[model samples]
Target: MDRRLFIKLLSQSALVSYGLLACPYLGWAKSAFDYALEGQELIQQKNFAEAIKALKESTRIDPNSDWSYGLLGRAHLGLGQKAEAVAAFREAVRLNPLDTYSRMMIEIVTQKPLPKLEKKKKPVSPLEQEAYSEEALMKSELKAEEGLEYQVKRVVIDAGHGGFDSGAVGKSGLKEKDVTLDLSLKLHEKLKADGKVKSFLTRTGDYYVPLSDRTATANQHQADLLISVHINANENKTPHGSETYFCSEKASSSEAEKVAALENSVIKFDEPYKKKAGYIDIEEILLKFEQQLYWNESGKFATTFQERFKKWLPLKSRGVHSANFYVLRMAKMPSILLETGFISNANDEEMLKKPAFREKIVNAIARGLA
Candidate 1:
């Protein structure tokens, strides 16, 4: 039987059978199921505005339905409401932790800038919520300090891509994985020698680490901060600059989103998250809330790092951006990703190959952290 027809008949049967019982829960389930089906059909017809209305009602009727949230996200995306799309998708992922599609959508939508809405007061995106919470937490911590010194003393440095995952390759044969690993090592040594901060590298040698494991290592170490380093690339080979990124539920721009997508492409290498037996939903919610609080601090630190980094580096500054990076998302501490330079650009590739230039890059990061 056709899947849609089968679903329609099943829904009809459910409504009739439950109507005899006059069960309130059954009424809600039937209505939600019907609305979800209608919304999905409208989406198929490209009637996004109507689909959104139907999906919203579906979600309101059954707030725990991951399917409804996912559909709402799709409708929002279709309308170019990126921030709303991200929020909806995030809820879907929270409800159904195994929903990889919703997780991927969160990554994709976050990389692009939030569209300007005509409304007077704009709704806060998840990124903004995180930043605000982080700011509040920092203020409270500082108030508690009462003149005591505060500092980040331990750090994690992750070199993007490795082993068979060569990352982007330059025309001059310089691989992104090698460059990132070399730079990470140099930065680690510099940080260690500074005596002010202790640093650890996610990988000390050329080998692949799953995107999820990189952050897992940081959380295990109880690190104060994490800096993920990478060499950027573009097909045009004209874009060359240094950019810093912090985790956000929505991307700051289309270009920023694309950069994230490229980095996240390594998700193919990741093994699925092992489902824990008898997981508590409240615990997961609290964990996510705590992570959101750290993101604001990450954003502030990223901006500071970019300012310090641009002063010493030869490359042009692209400034700071925010996007949903799987590597940055799970870290319990402030985390940022650095795109040092575009390997695809001829000039930047040559600079990246030189030891002096690499040392300069290392110095900039060390100084930035300090």
Candidate 2:
């Protein structure tokens, strides 16, 4: 049966079905507004699939309603149904040419390259010329503001543990510090060769650099992103996947907290976090407020990075996590810690030892950063 027919039948049944629609007049029937309102609430609750159902009913009832179509578009976008989102947004714009939200969303969702304006054959009249500069200015401003495009041009690559810090060690005697440095160097080369962005390293050789210094270097370089590379280890040596971590006040999971603790243990060699000193430093206070924004962006970036890496990396992707990583905590920009693989696991250890696998890891990280 057709979906519309199914909806119509469902709507009829909904007349007798309690709490199905937020309709008026004894709840016997629902207007487009009522259905749209239900969709809106469902969307607010982040139940995009159900919201789509209600939004579709609203559009069916009032095909010309711009608000219904706009809500429908939002529902589609929430579910990452991009093509459907664009279609609904276009319909909303078609129904009401002044729907700024839907109009901007269309460009944002599509991300189509801006067409270069062709040079005119003849100069326009003085009146047209007088308006041209201002129009061009507004057009550029609109694209930048409404486009919501984010770019990362400068990245700080941190090779976790140096000098005395050997980091995690495998049964085969592979040190996390050595593997990280090698990977970081390869990643630096890859990023530099790509010429897509500038990559800076916190440590260039076998020397101990404090965790705080790493974040400081990233800030001093004015990096757009900071990525600390490390290998993971577990006592049981069973886990063998890679994970990405972003800084947060609280870990996303127990495993995340443990991972953070393991990496943060290096702080013992560095000047450890002294118990809240007598005077709460103003810098610390400011960081508390500002870091939330950076942390959220970093979390989003970690997710994106994991998705990109999962496609090409041979190691199983353990996904992104939120942890209190000291190296990432003080970053003035978005930061992440990449647990490339489990050095404790035999298979992962052997893979890390291979030059080809290291190259693959470098490429994966480079693509993820891009």
Candidate 3:
């Protein structure tokens, strides 16, 4: 038999095994499957609106198909309908917990807007109420600090990509991994010299560290903060600026989501994180609430750090945004990721290649942390 025919037969057998062929709604299942395939093809062609329509039909025909829902989310995301994308992705994950792509999509979509509201004055859930209470406590602590004393005592600096991972490369031959590592080292030295707080580095030399391990290092040291250093890149090469980011369930903007996606693309190279047992139990629920509180604090700290760093940065300040970063997710302490400059731009690349420029960046970061 031909390879295509064999594959088709195998797929049909699998569908039958799943009882898709024997169901009372077999016609609907077949229709949904056809529409889903069409939608995927359309998405590949960048015809997102048409793809969305097909995917919507697929979902309506077979609401339980997690694959169709995940495709629908991608279609919505391509059209910049973040709220719709998040909802579709959330349903996909709920129907199939092992759908890592859908889970990542939910994180990316929710990093900005904190999920969409169904109606005006929606009733708050118990989890939301607890998160709000913790947020209030955090605010009170901040308000009580009338003095200019440092809020963070110990910090772990993480250089984004290294070793075989050269990260984004510039036309001028500058590598993101090299720049981040150098910048991180300089910042660590400056912070240590200040003597106000202790400092540590996730990577002191050129090498790769898994994203999860980076946060594990911070947690092990019981650091007060984690600052991840990275360089931005763009296909258009027009965007050039420094942006600080805090981890959030929803992205604050489409641009922030794109950045998160770019950074997260590296996850394919890392080992899969083994989830702890009893993930859906009470302990996990409480841990999620605590993480939310940490995220709230991280947002505040990111804003302050951006404000101070912008004053000294020679490049444009894109300001602070929030997104779900894998490197920041597991951290117990407040964490932020900084995109120092766009390596894709010629002007920014030239500046980034200079030792003096990196030193200036280090000084700005040190002052911001202070």
Candidate 4:
């Protein structure tokens, strides 16, 4: 199908998914239809440059529409336009915070390695709202002595795997991709509601992404911090607990090999044409390790996370370890991978389904980062 038609179909799909098709009061239907048609036509012609214009016009016609931004972002992504694609995806989320696809795209495209956004006091939901106690105030003052010089402005929170790629499956049938996405969304909501830190997610849907692309997203956004969340599994099932990993300047041969293997596995799915041998090489990845500054600042951030995890979470803190995971290796700033818990563990699996439990996990994460 032509780009215009494809976009039109996508817009229709988005509307249907949103259950807003029968709304007579909102003139969104006609406006969405028009934009989708023109946007798809331009996109199909490989006219991404012009497609953005038409797609944006669609959004202007219907200010509350997310379809326009989504279609426009797709066009930009196809055209190798990172900046515009980032903006478009961001707009999609702003229009509909629950639009998982948009949220994921924003996380993938705009997350940067720099620490620019600092935490600010913002409004929170009734459930999350609470005044800082005198004791808490005293502690904050004391904690400032050890506070890292950099401030957190924007954070990139990655929900590992999605859509076609379910990283691991639990006995209860909960997909790793789905669980991470759920937790990431909860974290995003908490951060936004708290009005303390701006946050972004890497994948908001059930789609597969290149591992390299995930790290690139964080670098692009210049994120103050990057937290890639995942559930752990093992053949033994005996090992069940939460573990956090930070980047290591000196990854042992075995550790580096494992990191390369895990990240490389995803590359094959994205690049099937390369020989199987292509996945075995770690030399290239090791060369890229120096890109992340490991001297002082990153270490402090990692340490802070480890300290907070023990203070808050119920799970046993496996303590922070260094690894050569592709996601952590590519971040230009402080980054960590959080293995929330072993999904394979029967006990952990049950707790994963509860909303309150998930919120508690989110709180711990926020507090850890704070």
Error of 2 at 320 (Å): 0.9
Model 3, CA-based lDDT: 0.81
Compute the lDDT of residue 77 as modeled in candidate 1. 71
For residues 2-44, could you state the per-residue lDDT of candidate 1 as single tens digits?
3433333332212122242233355533466567878999976
**Model 1 quality (TM-score):** 0.60
* TM-score, every prediction: 0.60, 0.60, 0.60, 0.54
Question: Evaluated with lDDT, which candidate comes out highest?
Answer: 2
Q: Which scores better on lDDT, 3 or 4?
A: 3
Better of 1 and 4 by TM-score: 1
Error of 1 at 342 (Å): 0.3
Expressed as tens digits, the lDDT of each residue in 57-173 for candidate 4 is 777766556777877887887666767877887777666565666665665455443223345655543322222233355468768965654467789999887777787778989
lDDT for model 1: 0.80
Q: How big is the positional error of residue 202 in model 1, measured in Å on the Cα after superposition?
A: 0.3
Clashes of each: 3, 2, 9, 22
For residue 93, model 2's alpha carbon misses the true position, in angstroms, by: 39
Decide which is better by TM-score, 2 or 3: 3
CA lDDT, candidate 4, residue 278: 29
Clashing pairs in 3: 110-249, 110-250, 110-251, 111-249, 111-250, 111-251, 112-250, 112-251, 112-252
